[model samples]
Target: MSKALGYKSFGGSDVQEFFSRPDLTPSPVEVLVQVAAAGVNPADHKLRSGEAPDLNGHLPFPQVLGLEAAGTVLAVGAEVTGLAVGDRVTGFALTGAGTYAETTLLLGAATARIPDALPETWAATIPVAGTTALDVLDQLDLPAGSSVLVNGIGGGVGIAVAQIARDRGLVVTGTAGTAKRDLVTSTGASFVDYTGGDVVERLRALAPEGFDAAVDTVGGPSLHEIAGLAKVLVSVGDQSVTELGGATVERRVDRSGLERVAELMVTGRLDPHITATYPLAQADEALALVESKHATGKVVIDLRL
Candidate 1:
């Protein structure tokens, strides 16, 4: 049997529970991974709370809860190639098998081999936050020296976007809560505290001519307020950004994107910034930290812990 964390029904953090299940079996194009670490993301809670419908529409009840993981491949389906048992890798759980468990299934096309030198904890964060950051920036395709504003730049994807933007030579200014001030500034982004008085006034004072592009990680009224601050805008947090003339991120959760992120990490161009790791037993605490919106960097669940 394999141990896993999940929810019996959609609700809140209080709905989460632990249970045991039979070992997972990979499909013809999937890989069976022995998960060493699972990246905790806002999407996890969003899916658990019934805010996002199950994309597959076939996930069983008492749904498992995670999207990305890094570990050793224990087995591969008959149709799988270029991977083998015992390969260290990172991948998205596109099959809806979920990663917050001792074992899970990863789609073969979305999984990529990790460099031997990269730690599994960091590799675990690549599928969602890393790829999302790359995808949004690539979609914007902003030139060097252009000014960009990252609305709500405190979370995992936002932080990755800030760092990647800096590397591309774009001038980055970010809006974040006061709790994340130091963390945001450390990425070389000029930080604006969103909780302070008059956010637009503060932004005008920072970028007199307005930004060339904007990527939002926080939605609702704040997104509405900042939508006009840039010529181009995209939101990863909410699809409602479209009503305001902006669009949601163009996600690319493929092996190439995963490989690119792994290369970046191997070359010191990216950091997952995993601030805290929880054992599978304490998965609730880890999820709570992310759900609270105060988590500075990435959070991961270590299955071996």
Candidate 2:
């Protein structure tokens, strides 16, 4: 049997129930994995709290919750190629059940080889938010040397967006609180401190003509306020940020984003940043850090298998 985190209730930290399940064997399209690490994301909280829009009764109480992870493929199912037993891989799991398990079954295509040099903890942080960043930026159409303003540049996705945008030759400018300034700037982006009340005014002073493009990973009334100075806005959150912010809002690109970002990571243009890690039993703590809305980089759950 395998130990997995499940939720018998909804809302609050008490929703989770860590329990055991019969050890799962991989099907033809699945790969058996020993989870090395899992990522804690705001989306996970949103889903658990009943705040996400797609619930529609798809998952019920006692359900496992998680999306991405880094692990070793203990065994590969038949009919799969380009992967084998003992491969080091990181990927999202919907087909393998979930990532919050000691061992999991994962969709073959979702798994990809992680670089040997990257730690499993670091590799685990890349798939979900990294792929989302790739998708958002790809659709923004920022051209070489174009100026951009990225709001919410404090976490994994924001940092990825800043770096990818810079790699594409854009003059990337970003927003982060004072404490997270260094992390945001580490992505080689010009930093904007939005904790101050007059950030929009400051931006106008520095860039009077407004940015050529914008990304809003933090969706709120404030996002709309700042985005009024941008020509186009990309998002993975509330669309109202665009309608009220005066910039075009797009949801995402496509599934191809994951593979594309992996290429960038391999080429050294983008790197995964792991801010903090908690043990598997401390998964709840990790989730809190990410959900606190203050994580400077991706918060991770180390399975330590």
Candidate 3:
């Protein structure tokens, strides 16, 4: 049996509890992993709260939390290639075999081996935040010297987008709260405190000609407010972006993409800037911080602790 943190039913944190379950069995094209670390995101609580039924409604009760993790492969399925037991890897826990446990299953094609120098905690954040940043920037495809705006640049994906965009030679400007100013600027992005004053005017003052592209991590009126500031726009989770003549991020989930980002990490071109970590026993606190929507940079569950 494996000890796991999961919700017996979809609701709030009240529904969460720790329980024991049979060790996950990998299906064809899946790899069984002993999780070393797991990335915590807003999506975890959203799924647990029944906000994303399309993703969890069909799964059995007591569904586990978490989408991304880094760990050692304990077993591999028949159809899996390029991976074997004992390999260190990072990938998505896509089989409803959640990563917030002692063991889980990762999709074989989606998993990538971790670079020798990378820490498991940092690799754990790549599957979601790192990949989303890559995808949104790829969707924008602006040339070097183009101006880009990152809306909500303090969160996991936003911070990553700022860094990668700067590395790509795009002039990056990001809007975040006062608390995240240092973090946002650490990526070399010009920071706009969204809470300081009129955001539209602030943005306009920075780019009177409008930005070449914009990547939004925060949605709603905030998205609408900045939608006109960029000629091209992509959002991480908000599909309503289409109504504003923008498109949702096109995620490319595959080993190559994962490896590319891992290479970036190894080469020192990108950083997840994980600001907080928690042991599995305190996974609730780790998740609550991310669910609060005020977490700066990445929050991770480090099972190794």
Among the numbered candidates, top TM-score falls to 3
True-structure lDDT of candidate 3: 0.92
**So what's the TM-score on candidate 1?**
0.97
Looking at model 3, which ten-residue stretch has the lowest summed lDDT? 93-102
Candidate 2 local lDDT, 1-305, one digit each (tens): 88888676567777777899888888897788999998878877777776764651466456666778889999888966678888898877762267888988777777788866677887776778888787777687666989988888887788888888888888988888999888887878888898777888988987899998778888887686776788777666775764665433443322245556667777888876777888888788778788888888788889883
| Best-first order by TM-score | 3, 1, 2
Candidate 2: segments with Cα more than 4 A from true spot: 53-56, 77-79, 241-256
Arranged by lDDT, best first: 3, 1, 2
lDDT of each: 0.90, 0.77, 0.92
lDDT of 1 by residue, 230-285 (tens): 99999987888999898899887789999999998899988888899999999889
Candidate 3 stretches greater than 4 Å from native? none
- Name the lDDT value of residue 176 in candidate 3: 91
Clashing pairs in 1: none
How far residue 10's Cα lies from its native spot in candidate 2, in Å, is 1.8
The global Cα lDDT (0 to 1) of model 2 is 0.77
